[model samples]
Target: MKTAVIYNSDLHFEHKQWESELAFWKDELKSFNNRLGELVTRWTDKDVLAQLEHYQNEFILHGNVIEDLQEAMEKHEMNISEHSNKLGDTMDVPMFSTHKEIREKMETQRQIYADLKKDFFRFLSKYM
Candidate 1:
C-alpha cells in the first residue's frame, strides 16, 4: 500500500515536469518564429526564403503537437484525480500503462525538437 502511494506520487511529479517542459518548448517556438521573422527581411534569395517558409510551417506543426500532448496529459491527470477521489490512494492498472505511453510520447517529442534545433542552427550558420 505504501509503495503504491509512492509510485503514484512519482507519476504525478513526472506529469508536472512534462507540463513544465511543454510550456518551455512552446515559448521557445515563439522565439524561433521571431528569429525567422528577422531572417525574412534580411534575406531575399529564393532558397533562403523557401527554407524560412519550411521552418515556419514546422514550428506551427510542432505547436499543435505540443497542444495535443498537453491536452492528453490534462485528461490523464483528470482521470487519475477522479479515480483517487473514488478509491483512495490506489491507482488503476491501466493508468500505469497510460502513463508509460505519455512518457514515451514526451521522449519522442524531445528528440524531434532537438533535431529541429540542430537543423535550424545549421541553416543559420550557412545563411546568416
Candidate 2:
C-alpha cells in the first residue's frame, strides 16, 4: 500500500532534531502498550479498560512527532518575521517576498499534514 508523506527544506534541515523526538515518542508508546498489556492481564479494576482506551487514543496523536516539530517550525516563522521586521525597520528589505514564500511553503506543508491526518485516521479506524 502507498502512504502519504510530509517534507520541506526546513524539515530536511531539522531531520536530526526530529529524530530524537520521534524516538522518544515511540519509546513512550511502546511503554504504554506494555503497561496496557499488564493492565489487561491483571483484571484488577473495572476502569482499567477505559483508561487503556483513553491512553490508546491519546497515544495516536502523541506518536505524531512530526506534528510537534512542524508546530515548532511554525513558531520559528514568527521569530523570523519579528527579526525581519526589525531589519526592515532599520534598513530597506522587501519583507513581503520572504513572507510570501514562507507562507506558500507553510500552506503546502499544512496541506500535506492534513492529508497525512486523513490517511492515518482512516487506516487506524479500520484496525480499531
Candidate 3:
C-alpha cells in the first residue's frame, strides 16, 4: 500500500527553491570549465596537459549533472540558459578553420585567461 505523506511548509518551501539551487551549480560548472579552457592553451607541459585532461573529464561529468538539473528545473518553469561554451571536452580545440569570429571570442575571454595564469605555475607544482 502507498501512503500520501505530507511535508511541512518549510520542507515544501525548500522543494520550491530547487531550481534556484540547481542554477547555482550550473553556473559554477560553466565558470570552472571556461577557466580550465583558458588554462589549456597556455600550458604545453605534459603533466599539466594530463591534469587538464583529468579536470576536463571531471567538469564534463559535472556538465551531465547540469543537464539533469536542467530537466528538474523545467518542471518548475525555470531552466539554466545554455551559454556558448566549447570548453572541457576531451576533444581538441574547436576548429577555428580560418575564421576571424573565433579571434573575437578569444579577445573577449582574455581576462579569464589572464586570471587563470596569475597563479598557474603554483597550481601546477602540486602535480609535479
Q: State candidate 2's TM-score.
A: 0.39
lDDT of 3 by residue, 32-126 (tens): 66767787888798988887887677656655755654454343221111111333212222222212232343344334434544444456565
Tens digits of per-residue lDDT for model 1, 41-116: 9999999999999999999999999999999999988888887788776667888889889999999999999999
The per-model lDDT (C-alpha) reads 0.89, 0.52, 0.48
Clashing pairs in 1: none
Worst 10 residues of 2 by lDDT: 88-97
What would the per-residue lDDT of candidate 2 be over residues 30-106, giving only the tens digit for each residue? 76566666656765655656655765675665556446555655565555546545653221234334434545654
User: Candidate 1 — worst ten consecutive residues by lDDT sum?
Assistant: 1-10
Candidate 2 clashes between residue pairs 3 or more apart in a chain or in different chains = none
RMSD of 3: 17.9
Tell me, by lDDT, which candidate is best: 1
Worst 10 residues of 3 by lDDT: 76-85
Residue 113's C-alpha lDDT in candidate 2? 45
Count the clashes in each prediction. 0, 0, 0
Better of 1 and 3 by lDDT: 1
Evaluate model 1: give its TM-score: 0.92
